[model samples]
Target chain A: MWDYSETVKEHFFNPRNAGAVADANAIGEVGSLSCGDALRLTLKVDPATDTIQAAGFQTFGCGSAIASSSALTELIKGMTLDQALHVSNQDIADFLEGLPPEKMHCSVMGREALQAAVANYRGEVWQDDHEEGALVCKCFAVDAVLIEETIRANGLSSVEAVTHYTKAGGGCSACHEGIEEILTRVLAEQGKTFDPAAAPPPADKSGSAGARLGTLARIRRIEHAIEAIRPNLQRDHGDVELVDIDGKNVFVNMTGACAGCQMATTTLEGIQQRIVEDLGEFVRVLPAQAMPQTTNNQ
Target chain B: MTQAPAGIYLDNNATTMVAPEVVEAMLPYFTEQFGNPSSMHQFGDRVGRALKTARQQVQALLGAALDSEIVFTSCGTESDATAILSALKAQPERREIITTVVEHPAVLSLCEHLEKEGYTVHYLRVDRKGRLDMQQYLDALSSKVAIVSVMWANNETGTLFPVEEMAELARSAGVMFHTDAVQVVGKIPIDLKRSAIDMLSLSGHKLHAPKGIGVLYLRRGTRFRPLLRGGHQERGRRAGTENSASIVALGKACELALAHMDAEKTQVRMLRDRLERGILAQVPNAFVTGDPSNRLPNTCNIAFEYIEGEAILLLLNKAGIAASSGSACTSGSLEPSHVMRAMDIPFTAAHGTTRFSLSRYNTVADIDRVIAAVPPIVAQLRRLSPYWDASAGAPLAEPETAFQPAYA
Candidate 1:
């Protein structure tokens, strides 16, 4: 459980200005039920003063989210629309005394809603054409545009921080790689470089000779290694065929003397070690009988 | 000052208060009987006797034929690891595992690790009611499977799985079967002699015993490998000196559980039903999450539409009532629990799921307090919710493909 501050709990329990202003002129809406949080900010602006006369919110989320939205209303009220535009999510969190790192997205939602409200007041677009960007987090419905915005706004370098700021990688985590890619690109655009080492090891697509060989070529290489070792195995009246190759897995069928042999494990290990020595470290040779083979052998 | 006031606790599935008898049973071991059971002195003799009695107590509760079959470990996770890893090590030829998608993190996370280590894991799916498909399970028990590990009852939903029948099926296929019965041990009756479960895992804390102690029940002559290899504690099946105090407490807890088992099903079931019925009557757009008739007696998982759970929980906390949620906000994740997601519960409702688990210590007044405190809270949150439609009993703007089941 989070060690939420008293102020946060108070604001969440008894939120100030917690309903849509029926007579409000400028309105902003962000997030969705699918994202697990949403906020609708209604602002009544005094046209003569160009200031926010009243602010109200309808939030669909957690305690911290409601508190953030409530805090946003208090912070932006009685301020010029221009001044309210500069109220960051950090400022909302600060008003609540603080939010948990994981709940920081609640404050971010408040900031986004404020931006949208101000944009509506100015009759300007709040963000780029979000539809043009591809969806990155299907679970939260967070798209690349939102991910990039959060990454740049917070200078986020890690997937965890991105989740806290935008809730992009906080779901099934299937979109972490996509989030990392966006973070790298956005940081690069800002003339800042993310530490690649801090990220998960990239899929081995370095095009090194051993790593780049096509599946058929890799299979051929394994067969060649088997041919070299066949003479020694034939001395024991045993011959092995390349039954299948699946990623790092190499399936081999041992016939004649090797079939149902008591030394099958030893021979399989010997064959696997020999392949690793001849082919690469990623290769793992197993007896075809050990696992049901997915590939057919000629 | 931020500490929550003493209040009604309906989150027993998360952890239970240590029973007074269990605490009394453990007090002696902490000071008077502090000797290591492994030592060759008189002090060790007394400690060893206490350990034996504790094992017997747990054995009696589980209806295992012998006390020696039980091996104590640090917690449920350790017990689960010890059993599953032992099966893999004992049967090195088999490379496949069978488990459900709704298992606790102790089993799910371990299966993920095993998969990374090249073991194929077949995650059995559950129906909308969170019940397993028998045909899917039986078909998964092929010759390639080393072990079948499934939880007896789901922690979040309280839905019980047909583990005894599943274990029998695995036994016929010559496959090892293990059940993480941490949630079921105290609440339900378990007889290893009558069941085909080769191994079972139980945690002390879930059964009113203190934390830091768990048990792995291995049927006699079951081939096994120790997860922690060192000293000859637990008859060489587990290493390191015994946690003498917690072991004694667990034994006392098991005895208490066995004594209260009948009342738990009767009185506790009554209290749970009262809360469920009351809430359903008071709150609009609320429904149960699992097999209503087949779940554990003390558990009730209800989902409220149009309002998230954390907001509800916070209001409840202010009212001096405590519960838990499968909500993304509570879990510190962007999605709700995997159990709810696997059931394909509508995202709008899933985010609002809350679990109220009761214990024997609770009273009817506690239930009454919760029933009264909850309706107003839900009403307030719904009023503040943008999706809520006061006239219609649903969200005003439901997602395009929320997958609302007929029952929902």
Candidate 2:
């Protein structure tokens, strides 16, 4: 469970400005029932003053999400639409002292609702639903446009970090590659490397989580190295299937013409060298047939 | 603004409080009787004797013909992994696993990993009331299947499965059968001698034992291959030094559990029913989930429409009540529990499920506190909910869903 702050708990137990604002002119809806969370934000804006006279919300999510929405309503009530538009997700999280990295997406949802509401006031298109060629995560319906914007705003550098911010790769995990591409491109634009393995892990009590992530990152690097070799094999009407990665051994299957070819040994050596170069660690690429069956399950 | 108050635990399905008697039974092993059971010295012999008694105690509870069938492991996950993996290893030709979608993660996750390792797993479906599709289970059984692992009781819904019948069907097909009876063991009577169950897995913590001790009941004469290989611990079925203190605690806990098993169906059931009825009577649009008539006596899973479960849990926590939920918010994965999803519960109620699992330790006061504390919290969250407005109109359950099953 998240170690939520007292203020977060306070706002959750006693939310402010709940329900639809009476005679509200601007309304923003974000999230969906299928995604397991949704928010409807209504703003009572004074046209003459260009300020939000009142704000109310209806949120269907976890405790942190509810608290974040409550805090967002409290933060935006007295601000002009222009000023409220500048309220970042970080600001919402800061208002709550902090939300767990796993729950930072709640604050992001609050920011998205604000942007959508302000756009509603201006009669502008606020794309929260899936757009043509824009959806990146089909499971959660997260879009690349929103993913890019969130990555830039939060300075997220890892796929997991992006998930904690936008919930892009939190479901099915098929979109992790899509999220990784966006994170790399955005972090590159910021002149930063998207390597969470090198960065200090968030202050979670699970002290070994950072080292565990390092292992995961290394495994991902190994998988990518094999992927890079796939095109080389595919060009010759043959394919290599990654069977298993057991410690320093990378078990793979060379199917099609490459299966029993005389050059298989040299090919395995080449793959082994590529893995070593890519990971800066020793590893042997052995054929799947050579994988010993004695390695029992535990 | 008030500090959290004294907690009334109703999350026994998650884990139970260790009984004081069980703790006392374990204390001497931790401090004085510390020698290894395998050691040859007198101190070790004494501990080894205790270990034998512990095994018999566990055996008596499980009603296994022999104490040797009980292979102690680190936890229920290990026990489950051992039973399933050993089944597959015992029959190298069979590359498939048959299990239910509503299984605890211990079995479901292992099956998933096995799938990646080139194993075909058939996750049989469950109906809306948490009943497994018997036709689906029968169809999924074949020569390619190595084992059929089903839970005796679901952790979330407390709905009982027809494991005895399932085991019989599997045996006729010449396939091994295992039941994750972790939630069912102490809550109900088990006479394993008369059953066709080939293996069973259970945890200590679920039945008032200290954590880290579990039993993988491998029926005698079942072909076995150990998941953990090492010294001849658990008669070469499991490895590593025995968790002496916890094992002793589990033995005592099992004995105590056997003594109070009847109370679970009576006293605990009464408290559970009262809490369920009180909450449903006052909280509109709330209905129970799972097998209505065939559920465990101590579990109540209610879905309060329009309010998210985490919000309910947080407010319940403030009221000094402890329960669990099937909502995605509580799960590490950003989806509702697969059990809930497999049952095809609508999004409206799926995100709103709150589970209150009781144990024999609970009293009328605890149930009364939960009953009194829950109605307002649901109301408050509903009032805060955007869908609850009269103008918007709360999305009510279909008549079929609102027909609360015969369950608590």
Q: Which candidate comes out best when scored by lDDT?
A: 1
In candidate 2, the residue pairs with backbone N, CA or C atoms under 3 Å apart (3 or more residues apart, or in different chains) clash, namely B292-B407
Top candidate (DockQ):
1
Candidate 1 achieves a global lDDT of 0.84
lDDT of 2 by residue, B1-408 (tens): 343566899999999999999999999998899999999899889889898999999999999999999989988999899889898898999999999999999999889879968999999899999998999989989999999999999999999999999999999999999999999999899999889999999999999998889999999999999998999988888989999889999999999989998998899888888998888888778999998699899899998877788888888887888899988777634667788888899877898999999999888988888888998888778776655653544543352243221111
Clashes of 1: 0
- Candidate 2 ranges with C-alpha deviation above 4 Å: A129-298, B1-5, B390-408
Q: TM-scores, in order shown?
A: 0.76, 0.76
Segments of candidate 1 deviating more than 4 angstroms: A32-35, A123-125, A128-298, B1-6, B390-408
lDDT of 1 by residue, A166-212 (tens): 55666578988778778778878989777756853232332443556
Quote the B-chain TM-score, candidate 2. Answer: 0.95
